[model samples]
Target: MNPINKVSQARVMSPILSGLIYAFVIMFAGTLFTSLILLLTSANESNLPAFSYINHIISLLVGGWVAGKKSGTKGWYYGGMLGCIYTLIIFMIAFLSFDAGLNGRSFLLLCVSLLSAGIGGIFGVNSRK
Candidate 1:
C-alpha cells in the first residue's frame, strides 16, 4: 500500500515475464524432442499426434512449474495468470491466422490449460530449492 513497499516489490522481477520465458523454453525443448523422435522413428502419422499432445502438456506443466518456482510466492496465481495469457495468445493467433471459429470446446480448452498450469504451480512451490 505504501510507496516504499511498492517500490520494493517493483524491484522484484515479474513472475509473469519469467513464466513466459519458461514457456518458451519448454516449447523449444518440446520441439527439439519431437524433431529428434520423428527423425529416429518410423512411427505411423497417427501416433505422432499422440506424442505431440503428451509433450505439449508436459511442456505446459514445466513452464508453469518454472514460473511458480521463480516467483517464490503465490504460485497458483502466477501460474494461472501465465496460462490465461498463453491461451489468449494462442486463441488470438488461431482467430487471426486461419480465421478459425471459436466454440464451446475452445473455451473448455482454456479452462483445462489454466487448471494444468495451476496444478504445476503447486508442485513448483512445494519442490525443494
Candidate 2:
C-alpha cells in the first residue's frame, strides 16, 4: 500500500474523546494522591473540599489543552465542548452513585470548568509544537 494511503487508513480518535480520557485519568490520579496525603499526614480535613475543586480545575484545563492541540483550530470551541461533555458525564455519575442533584454549587462548577477549559484551549492553539 502507498504511504499516503496507509496513513489515511489509520484510525484517528476524535479530539473530544481524547480530551475526556485525559481528564478522567487526571482526575483519578489526583483523587488517589489526595487520598494518600490525607491518610499519610495529619492534614486538616477541612481543606479537602478546596483541594477537590483545584483538582477538577486542573484536570479540565489539561484536557482542554489536549483537545485544542489535537484539533489545531477553534480551540475554545473544542475545549468548551469537552468541558460541557465532561460535566454532563460527571453529573450523571454523581446522580447515579450518590443521588446528587443539580444545585448552585453544580452550576458554579460548570461555569468554572468551562472557563478553565476555554483558557487552556486558547493557550494550546497558540503553543508551538
Candidate 3:
C-alpha cells in the first residue's frame, strides 16, 4: 500500500486518538452547557461546585457514547480512558482556577466521578447499535 494509505489505515486503527478527541469534545460541550445553565440560574461561584458535578455526569455519559461509537466493541476501554483524561484535565483546571479546598467531600466526589465514568464507558461499549 502507498504511505498515504498506510497512514489512513493507522488512523482508522487508532482508538486512543479517537477516544481522546471524544473526551475533549464532551468536556467542551459540558463546560458550555454548564456555563449556560449557571448563567440562566444566576448561580454564584460558591454554589457552582455543587452544580458542576451534574455537568461532569452529563459529560461522562456523552463521552462514553462518543467513545463507544468510535471504538465499536472496544468502546469500553476507550470511553474509560477518555473519562480519565477528562477528569485529569478538569481537576487541573480547577486546581489552577479556584481554591478547591482539600476536604472529604472533594475526595469523595473524585472517586465517584472516576467510577461513574468507568461504568458509563462499560455500558456504552456494550450498548446495542
Candidate 4:
C-alpha cells in the first residue's frame, strides 16, 4: 500500500477510538462534578441514579457526534456502533464488578443508547458544512 493510503486508512480507523476516549473523559469529568456536588450539598442520594443516566446519555451523545464527525459519512451507523460498543463494555463491567446481568433495564438502556447516539450522529453529519 502507498504510505499516504496507509496513513489515511489509519486516520479513518481512529474515529471510534477517539470517540471512546472522548466519551470516557466526559464521563469522568461529569462523575467528578457529581461527586463534588453530592459531597458539598444536601442533595438526596436518591438522585444519584438519575444523574448517572443523564451523564451516560450525554457522554454517549457527544461521543457519537465525535465519531460521526470524524467519519464524515454514515454517521448514524458509526454512532450506533460506538454506542453499542460502549454499552457492552459498561454491561461487562457491571456484570463483573456488581454481579449484574442482562435484564429488562439492560434492554431499555440499549435502546436509549442507540437512539441518543443515532440522533447525535444525525446532528453531527448535518452540522458539517
Candidate 5:
C-alpha cells in the first residue's frame, strides 16, 4: 500500500479511538454533573452511591448510541469499553471520596455497571448496523 493510503486508513481509525475517549469523558462528566446536582440540592445523600452507577449507565447508553451512529462496530466496542473504564474509575473515586458506610454494595454496583455496558454495546452495534 502507498504511504498516502496508509495515512488515510489511520485517519479512518482515528475516529474510533476518538469516540472511545469521548465516551469516557462523557461518562466522567456526567458522573460529576450528577454528583454536583445531588450535592447542591441536598437530595438525600443516602442515595448518592446508587446515583453514580445510574448516571454512568445513562451516559454510556447515550454515548454508545452516538458513537454507533458516527462510526460502527468499532465504535460500539470501544464505547462499551470506555463505559466500563469510566465506571471503574468512578467507583474508585466514590470509594475514596465518601464514607457512605457501604456494605458490599460496591461489588453490586460494579456488576450493574458491567451489565449496563453490555446492553449499551449490543444496542449500539445492532441498531447502527
Candidate 6:
C-alpha cells in the first residue's frame, strides 16, 4: 500500500499518536526555551545541561498526562513508552550532532524520566473522574 494511503486509512486516534503529538509540541517549546537560554548566558557558561534535563522532565510530564488520557488503560505503561521514545529521540540527536556518549548519569536520568512520566500518567488517569 502507498504510505500516504495507508496513513489515511489507519486509525487516527490512539495513545501512541497522542504521545507523539505531545512530544512534538514539547520539542518546539524546548527550542524556544533554548533560544532564551542562549541569549541569557554565554555558550560555555550556560547551564544548558541542567536546563535541558529539567525541560525534558517537563516535557515527559505533560506528554505522559496526555498519553494517559488517550490510553484509557495502562496509563503508566503508555507514559513510560512516551518518555522512552522522547528520550531516544533526544539521545539520537545528541549522538549525531556532537558525537556525544551516554554515561551513568545519563542512564539514571532516563530512568527518572520514565518514573516521573509514569507518575504523571497515574495522575492524569485518576484526575479525569
Compose the digit string of candidate 3's lDDT tens values, residues 1-67.
Answer: 6455443333464554565566567667878877887788867778776666776776676666656
Candidate 5 lDDT, tens digit per residue, 16-125? 34545655777678878877888789788888766766666676666655555555565446555655665567667767887454457766755665566556666666
Preferred candidate (lDDT higher): 4 or 5: 4
Sliding window of 10 residues with minimal summed lDDT for model 6:
2-11
Score residue 89 of candidate 6 by CA lDDT: 82
Q: Where does model 3 exceed 4 Å of error?
A: 1-8, 42-46, 99-106
> For residues 28-105, what per-residue lDDT tens digits would candidate 2 score against the true structure?
999999999999999888989888889889999999988888888888998999889999998999999999999998
What are the per-residue Cα lDDT tens digits for candidate 6 across 17-107? 6876886688679968787878876765356777777777777788788888877678898888877887788789879998988998669
Please, what are the lDDT tens digits per residue for candidate 4 over residues 1-129? 645544333574576777788888998999999999999999988999788888888988898888888888888987898889889998999999999999987988898888887777777777775
Error of 1 at 129 (Å): 6.2
Model 5 whole-model lDDT (C-alpha atoms): 0.62
Task: Give the winner by lDDT.
Answer: 2
How close is each model in CA RMSD to the real structure? 4.8, 2.4, 4.4, 3.4, 4.8, 6.7
Residue 38 CA displacement from its true place in model 6, Å: 3.8
Q: Candidate 1: worst 10 consecutive residues by lDDT?
A: 2-11
Local accuracy by lDDT, each model: 0.75, 0.88, 0.66, 0.84, 0.62, 0.77
Where does candidate 6 clash, by residue pair? none
Q: After superposition, how far is residue 8 of candidate 4 from its true place, in Å?
A: 5.9
Order the numbered candidates by lDDT, best leading: 2, 4, 6, 1, 3, 5
Candidate 1 — which pairs collide? Answer: none
By summed lDDT, the worst window of 10 consecutive residues in model 4 runs over: 1-10
- Flag regions of model 1 displaced more than 4 Å: 1-12, 103-105
Best by TM-score: 2
**What is the Cα root-mean-square deviation between model 2 and the actual structure?**
2.4
lDDT of 1: 0.75
Q: Please tell me which model should have the higher TM-score, number 1 or number 4.
A: 4
